[model samples]
Target: MEERARTEEEEMTLEEAFVRLDGMVERLETRGIPLEESFQIYKEGMELLKKCNDKIDTVEKKMLQVNKSGEYSEF
Candidate 1:
């Protein structure tokens, strides 16, 4: 199941994942959601969070590569 989630996440841009995560947050915050459904949303949110972090990491690595001095600098 995680493998499938990762594959799907790979196809999703970070902005899209952020939008999905925001929706999940709104759903979780609303009244009347069942406990089970809330748990599912939480799980999906975590997965999206991980994907966003992975995407950010990839971008940071590329930024570092572009810098010839091999030192981290504020973008």
Candidate 2:
């Protein structure tokens, strides 16, 4: 069988990722969890945060492209 890669949508959109991360924060702040579980939640939240940041950076680059000069020049 051929191997397959996961799609970005299959993983999680930046919005979805942020929502989950926010949930993690609420859980940590208001609802206490076992130390072990807290670490896992924090780790997962960090990973999601990276994905959201990456998406934001991609959007910023595209915006810069749209705000180009006379013509689209290589950066």
Best by TM-score: 1
User: What TM-scores do the predictions have?
Assistant: 0.74, 0.66
List candidate 1 segments past 4 Å from native: 1-6, 65-75
Candidate 2 RMSD to the correct structure: 4.6
Model 2 alpha-carbon drift over 4 Å, by segment: 1-11, 65-75
Q: Which ten contiguous residues of candidate 1 have the minimum total lDDT?
A: 64-73
Best by lDDT: 1
State each candidate's clash count.
0, 0
Residue pairs whose backbone atoms clash in candidate 1: none
> What is the C-alpha lDDT profile of model 2 across 1-75, one tens digit per residue?
112222542367777777777889998886658898888888867866777788878777766332345565323
